[model samples]
Target: MSPSPPLPKERRIRWGYWRSMMKIELTRQNVHNEFAKKVELISGQNLFACYQCGNCTAGCPVAFGMEVGPHQVIRYTLLGLEEEALGVNTFWLCASCLQCTSRCPKGIDIARVMDALRTVVLRKKERKDHVRIPEFPEGFLEKVPQIAFVSGFRKFLS
Candidate 1:
């Protein structure tokens, strides 16, 4: 038999007092360049390259397990929703296998872009107390290998 149909893209709180489906109300004032520009600079991938065809998400091995897939990450990143993109499991769960990059019609290196996003959020001084950056803490540092240690510094450090 065919696999069961997927759930709807949007959802509602029918039982609760909240009656409307969740919506992203994009205010004109909220749109800004700070986040997306940094991601593009770090990844060296143009946001203009993406046309939202969902190829990256479809080819991702871990997409099924991610709270946000590669495509949504790109969309959210471009939309300047840095917190939303950074807060998701998509970047952490990515295997860096390059399946999404290889399959992209836009020739975007989505995996690298995800890494760039990770770098931006992890390196933010203001966010340190809230998130556990894998690079920090003495016990965590010594246990992590040299390659990982160096790579983390290179990726996240300015």
Candidate 2:
């Protein structure tokens, strides 16, 4: 049989980069933290149901721009790695189109999970006094009425 062709240099480099992901030691306490519980409560989805099928990430339209992607965020949450899960911009970049939700074989509402993550990140105890609107997408400001933006800012900003 013929030997397999050697991978291109760039492909090999990319493989190495993926192989260098951070390692974490999981424990019962860390895996059952309040953050994970809150996420499940807010999202009303079973975090343990996901089996890392990669379907959600594969179907996400903006996954390319995300630092961690949806699946990784869920994994981090399940492992009670709140800081790591919240640190990535994956939840912020979510388009909320439900593409990932639709593609999930486990029937998880991935969009809701993203929303819950956003809520947790934005409403941290230290930042509760300061509320601000998230950055509107390009062309969104132009399309939305000024009064709506004004009312929302006034209500949220307090």
Candidate 3:
């Protein structure tokens, strides 16, 4: 049989390959940052345990309106992209219903994580970038502090 030509070597890496590689490197670096440690400490949850199962996404009612879904938020948490995760409107939009927490196969307290992300975002003043929904019910922020104070006092008494 005639000798076949040798298979051609790939002369250039595709853009997708470079993008994926960059994303992976960024995720690795993010996971090792101080903000990630702070997030874990404040949330009292191990973000690294998540496997991106999408249960949180399925449970999120506002995820459809978010730039990043709940599952992506969890992934961002695991990747340690604290600013990106917290800066996103998704964290602010969380209803704190605990559906994500209840549905997580790994038993990750996703609701707690959302609360932690919100606290961090507020502390950093990143809420300035959050999209304002005119349809959002009034007196939302007013109720939160009262609830938090009551809860804190209850805890203190306990």
- The candidate that wins on TM-score is 2
Write candidate 1's Cα lDDT for 60-126 as tens digits.
8889999978898888887888778888989878778899999998889998998888778767877
Candidate 3: clashing pairs of residues: none
Off by over 4 Å in 3: 1-23, 26-30, 125-158
Greater-lDDT candidate between 1 and 3? 1
Supply candidate 2's per-residue lDDT for 153. 48
lDDT ranking from best candidate downward: 2, 1, 3
lDDT of 1 at 46: 90
Badly placed stretches (over 4 Å) of model 1 are 1-32, 127-158
Ranking by TM-score: 2, 1, 3
Taking all chains together, the TM-score of candidate 2 against the true structure is 0.68
Q: 74 in model 2: Cα distance from truth in Å?
A: 0.4
Backbone N/Cα/C clashes per model: 0, 0, 0
Candidate 2: give its CA RMSD in angstroms. Answer: 7.0
Off by over 4 Å in 2: 1-26, 128-158
Worst 10 residues of 2 by lDDT: 149-158
- Estimate every model's Cα lDDT from 0 to 1: 0.79, 0.83, 0.72
Work out the TM-score per prediction. 0.65, 0.68, 0.63
lDDT of 2 by residue, 27-106 (tens): 88878888889999988999889999999999999999999879999999999888899999998788778999999988
